[model samples]
Target: MASNVAQFAEGEDPQQMSSDTAALQDQGWALDTDGMGVTKTFHFKSYFKAVAFVNLIAAESSAKKHHPTMTMRIGSVDVHWTTHRPRGLTHKDIDLARHCDRGAGLMGAVESGQGIKCGPKN
Candidate 1:
């Protein structure tokens, strides 16, 4: 989907980032308000399933060597992707976000389509 961005390079320029962000948004990801990352949350019926989804993402990130920050709760997992080297979102982040969508689907997670939400503070 989204014009076969499978081979997209990392650290794409600003215009390219905008295009990639639009495509990713169509797939249920949203750019963080701070303009540094993209994030989406997936919901599960059980804590075990949520953790399983996180595990799946962990394995994929490890294999790709592009890790994401994952937050797991009782029945959800939020995935955030950004490239630190270039100091902003990039094609790598978009691709990984797409991969996470597919991976979560395979694991039977119901994608929220609501972007991100912070947890309770200490």
Candidate 2:
């Protein structure tokens, strides 16, 4: 809903949205119970990698003019994509979610168990 994004762009149709959301869900993204957005948590080997991933996302979002809500941690980042203007999921959301998957891979994202955690060691 930023001035940079197209004001006329709208959310996807239910049918098309189903398939689009499904693909992201298979990649670990979860559809919001309210059916308005999608979320995923990407893990990394170190704090540096995690921060790098966030930066990667930031660059892409800026270029696309569609930003996501990101919560960064020592070894992970939780990303939620939703079109505020459209008030639901849209093509931009789908595209950006896929970009996130690709970026995470490039950043050496790891499984939750394998990721570095900021806490006392066992």
Candidate 3:
């Protein structure tokens, strides 16, 4: 469920940030302690699944001209979103964060305890 998402034209607006990030938090996202970005970790059953989730986000990022810094682990992908041009969290970041969640689900993401360790379960 991709949406037409865009970045704000200015820096972080504290008043707007509160409401903007609250819902995401409920969905397992973390607002950066530095207050510059948001992050979430998605667990998967394999490294391939983890990488696939990154590619899914990449496609969405390319479509929106907005991207997140993603670190793919053996069985988890860490996604961090922020707008450097406007120097803060934007609607783009929020929207993409949600997209990451969707993509994770589509990739068959598992819970942290169920994640693949080396490659596959024996």
Best by lDDT: 2
lDDT at position 104, candidate 1: 78
| Models ranked on TM-score | 2, 3, 1
Alpha carbon lDDT of each predicted model: 0.74, 0.83, 0.80
Clashing pairs in 1: none
lDDT of 2 by residue, 5-119 (tens): 1222364577777777778777888876566778888999999999899999999999999999999988889998888886777888889999999999999999988999877
Deviation from native of the Cα of residue 1 in model 2, angstroms? 26
lDDT of 3 by residue, 2-41 (tens): 1223233375565675677778888988766555678888
lDDT of 2: 0.83
Model 2: residues with Cα > 4 Å off, grouped in runs: 1-11
Candidate 1 local lDDT, 74-116, one digit each (tens):
7788788877786777777887898888887877776564323
**Model 3 TM-score (2 dp):** 0.83
Please state every model's RMSD to the true fold in angstroms.
7.2, 6.0, 6.3
Among all windows of 10 consecutive residues in model 3, the one with the lowest summed lDDT is 1-10
